[model samples]
Target: MRPRSRHRVDELLRELATWEPKELRELQAALGGLQTALERESSKTARQPSPGHIEEKYIQRGNKRHGPYLYLRYWEAGKLRSKYLGKKPE
Candidate 1:
């Protein structure tokens, strides 16, 4: 959290300390539900896959054109790599 948000949370907790026991219990239950929802959202996004990009490559062959080959390009291990999808029919 940012420094400002942390300060706000700190101030809120101080205020909570002065609340009645029944109110504190209600706040605890509400916080538990909020925490569960946030965790579920976090995990859902963590499982989604990124499809970097699609690229095409072209080549010249014996006075004829051979290209527009397709590839899936992405970054891995701090390096850029490509996975061949397919090539145009000869």
Candidate 2:
């Protein structure tokens, strides 16, 4: 990997070490859910769209517009979709 990519990987590893047990569990559950969804989609007889992709983003909500919370963005049926991941850590 390039130096920049290596540095980012190391930084992410360090950040992961700081996560609380609950946070880690949430991440694990999210990944497991993704896996299950993939498996279910594969078993369906109906033609499915090409495998979608995911990206991290921040989304805003509420009347006061009180966010920019972390989110997972992807494509489904050629439409963009997102799932909230919670607020960005300080």
Candidate 3:
């Protein structure tokens, strides 16, 4: 089977960018497949964290409710470490 193209997945991100305040469920559904792909990529063991964990952090950063925090994943000592991810709102 052919791999899915990033362009196709990018549609969801675009949709999310303009996503309505009230259509979160629909937005999530649109992005769900992309989200899963990101998770899978992040989990590759060469020196990365699990995809699920990475997705969690990405979602955290994307959330307006979180406001002040930024999120990141990094490799160190053969482990995927999640730090403060982002700062708390003042």
lDDT of each residue in 26-77, candidate 2, tens digit only:
5655565455446655676554443332334544555455545655544443
* Per-model TM values vs. the true structure: 0.44, 0.36, 0.23
| lDDT measured at residue 44 in model 3 versus the true structure, 0 to 100 | 56
- TM-score result, candidate 3: 0.23
Q: What ranking of all candidate models by lDDT puts the best one first?
A: 1, 2, 3
What is the lDDT of every predicted structure here?
Answer: 0.63, 0.59, 0.48
Say which prediction, candidate 1 or candidate 3, comes out ahead on lDDT: 1
Q: What lDDT is reached at residue 1 by model 2?
A: 50
Best by lDDT: 1
Better candidate number, 2 or 3, judged by lDDT: 2
Give the Å shift of residue 69 in candidate 3.
44
Candidate 3 displacement at residue 27 in angstroms: 4.1
Shift of residue 10 alpha carbon in model 2, Å: 6.2
Q: Where does candidate 3 have its weakest 10-residue lDDT segment?
A: 49-58
